[model samples]
Target: MIGVSGTLVRGGTSKCWLFDITDVHGRGASLEDVLLAAFGSQDHSQIDGVGGATSTTSKAAIISHSYESGVDIDYTFAQVGVGVNEVEWGSNCGNCGTAVGLYAVQSGLVRPRGEQTTVRMRNTNTGSRIDAVVDTPGGRFTPSGNATIPGVASPGVAVGLEFLDPVGSTTDALLPSGAAVDDFTLSEGAAHATLVDAGAPAALFDAEALGLTGAETVAEFGAALPSLLGLRHRAGVHMGLAAPGGPVSHAVPKFGVVGAPRDYTATDGTRIAAADYDISVRMASMHAPHPAIGLTSTVAVAAAATVQGSTVHAHAKARDGEIRLGTPAGVVSARLVLDGERLTGVRLNRSARVIARADIFVPRAERVPVALP
Candidate 1:
């Protein structure tokens, strides 16, 4: 057995376990083998390990100090599949980046610079740069704080992330298809999709085109999971996320539906009015609906809104780089800094807390497959 210690941190709306690079790979084991075993990917319920089983919870990242100029930390995000026994390393997680920022300074990877310490992170998975401004009072780290996010009830330390140069995070262009609006031929029929590569590659279709309001609850999104995955596959191919007639990723080219803002009941039973938010979105995180909007997807939504004919742009109400997205949990706000046609950065307020520190044990290196490419 291989025993490795990891930190469990709740960043933004999701939870991810952070591990030091050396601890997981000093034995020369494959990243997927270690992470899959650590998260108990073989079991759907993850009863044998620390994985929370849900898409948002079953996540892990390897952290290390970066020697790269202008970057303080580098991390590789792994979306460890539940029951599926797969680990997807093709995308970046904004929520995970939030956790890594706090983890970096808290663990002394980066020296805290009083008041607001900036931890510049590069997600090696997608090559996206995120400036995580952590709240370090008097140059000291605090484990918890009064800052709260939309989905989580508990408050934590505030970390504002500025996604620097987020355009074409995975692909090479903001509009990967070279157009703001691209028509994707779905199995049922043709659907017009706005495929934006900012933050992460995301393909958004008008919710009405899919026979539902974008403000639908998580369960509603789950009910249409099959159709959503199908759309994601096609979008991935269109965005060059995958080769045509090739194995498409179920993760990237984030699939979702967008709609005009309207009245809806939140998961917490709160009433949200049309005027309260700019647009509505129901995004699928892997196999199910993301209970709360992923910040990276929020970045994509904000980027798409800037386009003239994008689906998100067509439904959004807010202007001047302020985007308020209505999710299942509540509304998430993203601020875009623009210089003429150039998008300087995207800033978002998030809360993160160190949930637990644990020693995880997994099967020996030779016992797990190292065949994943």
Candidate 2:
């Protein structure tokens, strides 16, 4: 058996298995095999591994102390397929981004400079930089605080993150099609969608256009997965996210719908007032409605809201300052700094906690090699 030591951290609404880069062996096909074994990717339930059998829980973060001047750490986010036997490294995870600083400080990868330490992180996946600030009283990372985000049960240390130059993280353009709103015809019907690449590539549509009220429960949305995915696959081709006439199963560019804010019940059965938010958004990860808001999607939503003719912009009110977006879990806000026609940066705060630390043992049989091009 091969043992890999790592920590499991709950960052924002997702959990990730964090590993130091130097400790992980192999590359390319070999690395993929190792990860599949570590997470038990061939099984739907992931019962043989640490994965929680869901997209949110089947994530990994590979971190290394940065040698680049001005950057403190380099992070590469990986989306490990549950039963598909694939590992996609195309985009970064904003939820896991919040935990990078905590792991760095606690693991001595970075030393706190003052009461609060700001770690400049370089996302190797997208070549984007994010400034993550964590509260470090007396030069130590603190995980206890009053910071609370939707989906998370309790308060934890506040991690302020600013995604700098968030545009075009995955694709070559912010508006991949050179238009804010594009029309696509699917088997269901015609739909208007916005393809934005802020922090991550995402396709956004008006819920009404998709025959959704934007307040559907998780189960209701799951029942509509076929239609939703059909729209997503077409949008993916339109935005060059996927090859034309090819099968689409990759996690991104993400798919979501936006609507005018309305009163709705959260996943935890708590009522959310529409008056508190500017718009409502429901996003899908791996073809299912996300239990909570995704950090990268929040950035894309903020960017879409600022652009004219987009669905989010049409329903958005009180444009300046923070934009509160109501999701199935609750509301998550993003503050956008606009410079005329360009978006300068996006800022938001999330909480994270170290859940467990242990050695993941991979059997020799699971590490068998596969042919690669």
Candidate 3:
């Protein structure tokens, strides 16, 4: 039997289990094997493991104090597969980055500085850097406060997540195809897409073109899943994320449909007016509709909205400063800082909490030959 130590934390809209790098590597087992066993990846319900059995909840991270200059923490975001034995390391999660910030100080990885402890994290998966400002009043670590963000019901400690130079995390180009828009041919039909690589690689389409209102609730977005998933594959190829007729990435080029905000009811049944938000967004997580926008998606959308001919820009209302995203949960605010048309970084105000420190015992890992990222 293999014993694994983990800390579960609620970061923004997702729940992630963080494992110390030492614990993960000290076992002498492949990361795929250890994570699969710990998450019970072979079970759809994840009934036998700590996994929450959903895309947002079934995530894990390996973290350590970084030796890299100017960086304080190093982490690898692992999108552990649901009902399958696989892990995707091609992307990063800003929400998890929030959790890492808090966990760093709480775990003594970094010394608290004054009131705001800045935990500079380097995502080893995508080589993206994130500055997580954790609230530690008077140089004291604290995880609970009067702060809140959309999607999650309870309030927690505030963590400011800033993605620095986040463009081209995977493709090495802001616009992976060298153009703001690309033509795609999918089983659903033909459509124009904006394949941007900011924060995380993502493909955005105008909802009207996909026969969508962009304000559909999670349940209502069900019918459009097949077509959007098909679009993801085509966009992946166009962005050079995959070769022609090759297996596409399950994470990259995160798919989203955007439209001008219209009066609609949120998932919680709260009415939101068209004037209240700048744009509407419906992003997919793995195969399901994200209850709220992912921080990475929020970053990408804000950047895409700045492009004149991009899908998001075409549909978003004219706004200044922070961009408001009308998600199923509610409106989310994301700000893009630029220096004379050159984007510097994206900023988001999120909250996170350390749920628990746990010890998971794995009897035997399922035999699955999944590759490391």
Report the number of the highest-lDDT candidate: 1
The collision pairs in model 1 are none
Candidate 1 lDDT over 96-142, as tens digits, reads 99999999988999889889999999999999899999999888999
- Number of the candidate with higher lDDT, 1 or 2: 1
**Candidate 1: regions farther than 4 A off:** 185-189, 365-373
* Candidate 1 to truth, TM: 0.95
Candidate 2: tens digits of C-alpha lDDT, residues 103-222: 887788888888888889999988989988887888787757778888988887788889999998777688999998999876667889889989888999888988887777887777
The models' CA-based lDDT, in order, is 0.89, 0.85, 0.88
Q: How many backbone clashes does candidate 3 have?
A: 0
| TM-score of model number 2 | 0.94
Which parts of model 3 have CA positions greater than 4 angstroms off?
185-189, 366-373
Cα distance off (Å), candidate 3, residue 268: 1.3
User: Candidate 2: minimum summed lDDT over ten consecutive residues — where?
Assistant: 22-31
Alpha-carbon lDDT of model 3? 0.88
What is the TM-score of each predicted model, taking all chains together? 0.95, 0.94, 0.95
By lDDT rank, best first, the candidates go 1, 3, 2
